[model samples]
Target: MKLSSFLQYLDALGLLDLIVKLKLRNSILLVIMCHEIGKNVYYEEGIPTKLFEAELRYLLKLRFTFLPLCEALEIIEEEPERPHRIAVLTFDDAYKGVYENALPIMLKHGMRGTIYPVAGFVERSVAHWAVQIGFILRNMKTPVKIKLESLDTSLYINDEYDKRIALKTLLNMLPRMDVDEINSVIQCLTQFLDRELLHEIQELHERTMMNKEQLKEMAELGFEIGGHGYWHVGLTNISRERVRQEIESSLNFVNAFMSSSVCKLRTFAYPYGLYDDNVIGVLKELGFHAAVTMKPIVNKANNLKLYEIGRLSPYRFGLMTLSSFKVQLMRVYT
Candidate 1:
């Protein structure tokens, strides 16, 4: 098993707490990475809404102070010793569920968080590839053959399991394709399936991303808005000019939409949490204050970098019990 999984197993066994108690390190700021938070039929990336609420209550019970991402950054810079334990909640992709489901729970707890939305998706100019894939897979009635010329492979989906496998393989290959390539692949897949029915299904079930008005409301309601690129493509693998355009254009769109004092678009979350020195330089040049990655490390005042701040995904912790959550936090603290 992977080391992270093994650590989670140890945490489930209650050994991680003992290890953490023995180490006794200083308190640090933890950023929890989330995507969607609701009942999703096609995706498992999201935690159920009730479980999300329970996690928040559990954190509150532990006396962990929840702060907005910008506020957390300011505190770490201005007064590092103010809070013993603090966390910033952040969500990516700006799913409608976050606005519809997660926001209510956060407000109940008197907490605020950050959201990074793909500018293109919010503009309704592009559909999230994953959502599109899920719609196609679930709507397929008969066995179909899918030819992925980019991967030089042909996949046959004859059952639910085969459909899932094909979906997974397609998702894995999407980040590398450009806009036209991705659209071509989706178009090809749609031809094999029921295009008219799939469009209807997509119209009904696949409107999962938040629109501009919802995002505006979220910003007005004390949530920070950040950029997640224009097309949700990996920046590190793209050309330098493309990286600059993606980062700059995304931030520009977010700033124009929110237009709130509290919702300054100064932070960015890299697509797929993939970046390099070049990507960092691009963000720096664009006047962003900080950028977050999906790294498993905890963010401390002394060790935090503006460009490469690390965040922990709750799924990585195997969020089955409170003890497992504690162990996840401990993994980052050390």
Candidate 2:
């Protein structure tokens, strides 16, 4: 079996937790990354609000210190010898579910996290193309053939399993394609679906992202509202000028609402966890203090990189189970 798979097997047998605790040590930080938070079938991969609270309680039971992303990074940089289990809770996409559902549980725990909002998404009331695609596939009611000229491929989706495969196939191609190409694929797929469903995109977006007022409230509440790019596109694939514009636009949007807040930390999370050295340079030029990536690893004090900080997702293989979660912590923390 693969190493992670093997570890998960042990975790299922309730054997991994003891091993993790035995080898657990101080001086490491776990930067946990999350996305949508609600019980929406269309967003099947999203962590449910109840499960999120359970995860928080699990970490608290383990005596993990939850802090904002900036504070956690500062500690990793300046206090390498601190004896505690440190964690930074972060959410990407600024989904409405976060404000509607996750906020109450977090408030109850006295916890704070970083909120990475896609500026264009919040400003224009448009869902990211990927999110729209997900909604389309999840809500598919009949068999359909999706043709992608860009990829020179076609997928015949009939059942839930087939839909899952097609969704995975398209998402896998997103990182390699530019913004236009990704949008093109989405358009083609949506056209294949019913026209009535096309109108749902706007409704989906409105339900998917936080409105300006909600975002302002989050900032005022002291959550680190960080940038996730204006277009939510991968910066590494775009021109340097475009990259600068994307990052700058996002920062400006965040700063506009955060003007009244005391939290002024400038941070970013790479869209789709994709970035290169050039992207990092643009972020630095744009005055961002640090950026987080989707890489799953424990961040030790000595090895923390400001621009390439690694983050772990709560969902494993697009689903979150407490057993799998414990195993993930074990694999990284030990």
Candidate 3:
């Protein structure tokens, strides 16, 4: 990211609020947002982005899960048994780095957390959509941006797959986008987008997902595996039947392969936190233990809908959360 772009991104109000609200001076309960780091191994420009290893030692205490997962788990266990509050470490996407980089760290620390995976990407064996997009961004020469119909900034894409992924992201995030408008925009994108490029990327990242043996091993290590839906599509757009199918099919595939009963993957982090009462109701009927949403509030077991625990997201860049966590810890606990 250019210096100017980075500065502008930091100026985002949502980002600012997230940092400020994190100073929970009165809260006894909390959770940490642990992210699965994407490729730092293969970037042509000497690593496109990174969350400096040093940062882990700084803000995150036993809460950091990279090199010190075991310690984090110990912290949880050592907490007072009041149920007043506990900090659970969680990683959103099961990136390949979870295996290559994170596993060793987790093992050394003996920390256990849930790995929420997009089912088809692992079970059926396909490259994750995000990884494919990142590959193109890291590989492309000319900086490309999608020319949108009404958007202000030109869509920035480093490669073809990035262009597709970014469009999909916008489609999912922008709720009021009508199908007619979507179709037109997608059609325009197809004119310059390279399907083959995305396909190649897909092939590469499928190999990146843990093979059956590795996944089974993850279970053996005592880490919980949760479903993050199949295809990782915008859940709000699909029909009720389709949602059930995605949820159940992925659960079936993982559960059956494990030689254990997943029954149903009630524990979910909604695809982009998009959920309807109807969608959740199906999960209730099916019997899910718990489901997590991307809501940014502390969750109470009694007040929650069971299938809708809120979570905090770790920012890609910033110092606010680090400093803020300390302030919250000092003011409230003392």
Candidate 4:
């Protein structure tokens, strides 16, 4: 067996718990990152509701204290003891599933999480381009040939797997293309699918993102709302001026919908977890408390930078079994 599979087997057999118990006594802060939480339709970006609940229950059983990102930062700084294993739950892309499917589960456990919304998608009630691309490709009835003139690449999506591969390729290429160019590619692909069929797919795909009222309601429920950029564009690929606009606009948009007593737009999560020194400087200038990245590791308090805080994705936790999650927790500290 491969090394990773062997390690997973060890985790599944519950052997990794002994390592965690023996080696990791010191307090460590873990920030868990998730994109969506609902029934997995595309199976590309979400953890099913049952699996998510299981993970939360497992974490609570371990006595890991869940905190808001801002509060977690304060505790990590002020509390020298770090008495408990600290965890901060954050959901990216602000999908409606988070508020609908995930919120009730979190509330059952008396837990709260941070959500970062793509301002444009939230306001317009549309999926992010990346999501739209996936939905279109996944729901396509037959093989379709399309050429991305901007990237000078052509693809034929023949089946579900081909659709997945095409979606991945488009996602990697979109961040590097101009906004208009990206839209052109999407428009070109849409032409190959029937309009009514696309509409049918959208209706069946009930995982649309949260609307403004839902966002406001979530803020009232003690969930922190953060910015995920205006257009969900990669900051590093865009011009610095565009980066400033994206940051300022998204924060302002979310702040307008939030009550200061419940939540404020104080944090930012990089779109696609892509950033640069200029992006960090922009966030600092905008007076953000902290920013999160998609990095997969537990953060150490002593040498953490507010602007570039790393987060661990659920896939790193091994979503199939609780033992893998435990192993991931230990693996981070070890």
Candidate 5:
């Protein structure tokens, strides 16, 4: 059985909760990585607001203490005599869904987490390139035929299956290219798809990212407004100097907007959960206190690496379920 199904089976037999009680101890921290937080049809990983609330409620019932990213790092670094069963929520890419949908729910539950915005996206009011791709795939007409000259591949989308395959193929190929080439591919797609790329961008802009005002409001509300890079490109794929520019520009934008109270602990989530020695070095040089990756392992406080912190995401688990979520949470104690 798949893990989620297995967890469901355990739930059916009344063993899941028992297992949770037995295994979920208060000894480690669980950092959750998320993106959009509403019914983002174009964004698959985007969790609906109701489901997010359910997950939060489930975590609370299991007695996990929600910690801000900064406080969680402090506890791990200090190695306190007693550690709370900690969970930190980190939203990547500053989707407006977070401010419009996720924040109210989080506020109602007395929880605070971290938000990472792409400085360029927020400033330009544009969706991430991935979101732009999603918009094209979802809105393009049937029987679509397009050529990706960058990848030397052509897509023929006649039905939903073909559309999905085309999307997966493009998504897989796009990240491997540098930002300039990716832009070229997008421009090519806009032309071949015969769609008004600018109009689609405008449509997605409101759904994709928060503006200056919303970001400021979240910062004032005590959220750790962190950086996801200036352009949301993979830092590891760029030149070291370009990486420095991205990090410095991102930090400058975040630092300028975040309150001193929130800026006291500067944290970052890698744009694609990617980094290397050079990336880490740049982060340290730029004074980032902690950085999180897409790794799905729970953090062991005693052996934590501040700059190389790991995080978990529901997207990797196939499906979102309370039972599956509980099993994922059990990683903290295991």
Candidate 6:
């Protein structure tokens, strides 16, 4: 999945739509070359995180399904001014591998995208207690003291760069603690790991979050359901009435059982997309309409913003050409 991704090198630089469908540009360069094949078969050096998580689930199953049938059968079958149509295949903590591998590659290329999902880790495998206390004190062998209130580290991380310096020194002190010091450091590292290493550290984050019947089959497939706040935490470190009680308690948990979903559910992708300026004025007084940021830049309906929304972090494909996939999508949007 490294067809030199800068958004698949800006969709293979639409060079006259790959010179008018050279077989849909060799079938999206062989779907970004088997989407990074077996990417070092489940992460060797974690093969650049399994080649940018298999080319962002092969560019969200090639943008919600065959980039609109390769633009209605081969790039712009009808282009009357919608040229800013750059791919926006998103998926933040909207995980469960976006309903297992971006919805079966968006059913298999009938394509459509958008998913923000952190509504507090959905039907719960509940993560982000500082990446489950830095993978349980980086595979604790013992000697773990972490006190806080002044700092008294007992630290005993034996190797692998002292387990990435004890998981970046408790993620720079778990965002300055206080959720009862992050539930007493996730109950003192789940009382020194076990429950089979906390279910293999929640299956080492293969990204999970989609449950109530697969978010009701991604809200019956039209797919615009948004929101990410309910506990992936960080509304500029809490309060403005806890960021409207974490975005109206995650829009009442994605509207507890749809109940006729989409009610002016303007968009949101902030949890870990991080926010500020009073968290974009509490996502425009809680009626969002548009918000996304991991800040790479491309969304354009009159350049909307509650926060400077721009994205495209999926990269690391390594081959399948046109100058190495536009040098990894110009290194994620240049």
For each candidate in turn, the TM-score is 0.88, 0.87, 0.63, 0.89, 0.91, 0.28
- Measured with C-alpha atoms, the lDDT of residue 274 in candidate 3 is 80
Q: What is candidate 5's TM-score against the reference?
A: 0.91
Off by over 4 Å in 6: 1-89, 99-101, 105-107, 112-127, 130-184, 192-199, 202-235, 238-269, 272-274, 278-300, 306-334
Alpha carbon lDDT of residue 62, candidate 1? 58
lDDT of 2: 0.79
Which lDDT tens digits does candidate 1 get at residues 277-317? Answer: 99988888887889998887777766678788888776544
lDDT of each: 0.76, 0.79, 0.52, 0.76, 0.79, 0.51
lDDT of 6 by residue, 1-334 (tens): 5434454455556652343233222112111211112222121111143444445554443342333112221233234234423344555554454565556655564555555566766645565465566567656665454444334564564556665676667666655443556676667656766566767766644543355567667666655556777776667777688778888777677566345344334567776556877877777777665576666433332323435656644433535333343334432221
- List clashing residue pairs in candidate 4: none
lDDT by residue (1-334, candidate 4, tens digit) is 9656877789777788777666456666778888778744353657778878888987776677877786677766787555547778998887778888999998888888788888877766667677677777876777778887777989987887888788888888877765677778878888877777767545432456777788788777777888889888878998889999999998788677556425333888998889989999998898777899887777776557777788876655344555556656665531
Models sorted by lDDT, best on top:
2, 5, 1, 4, 3, 6
Q: Tens digit of lDDT per residue, candidate 5, span 1-334?
A: 8777777788899787787677655466778988888757473767867778888997888788787798777766666667657889998888878888989998998998888889988887777888888777776778878877777888898888887887788777754677788888878767655555557566777766788888888877878888788887878888999999999999999788655444377898987788999999999999888899887788776667888788877543677666666666556422
Model 2, runs deviating above 4 Å: 1-15, 41-43, 75-81, 138-143, 315-319
Better of 1 and 6 by TM-score: 1
In the range 1-334, model 2's lDDT, one tens digit per residue, is 7655775687777686776576456566788888788746353457877778888998888788888787676666666666647878898888778899888888888888889988988888888677788888887776888778899998999899998898888777776777678778877877776788778887977777788888788777777888999888878778889899999999898778667455556889999898988999888887899999888877775566888888877856544676667756754632
RMSD of each: 3.4, 3.2, 8.1, 2.8, 2.3, 17.1
Give the per-residue Cα lDDT of candidate 5 at 87. Answer: 83
Best TM-score goes to which candidate? Answer: 5
Clashes of each: 0, 0, 5, 0, 0, 14
Residue 232 displacement in candidate 3 (angstroms): 1.1
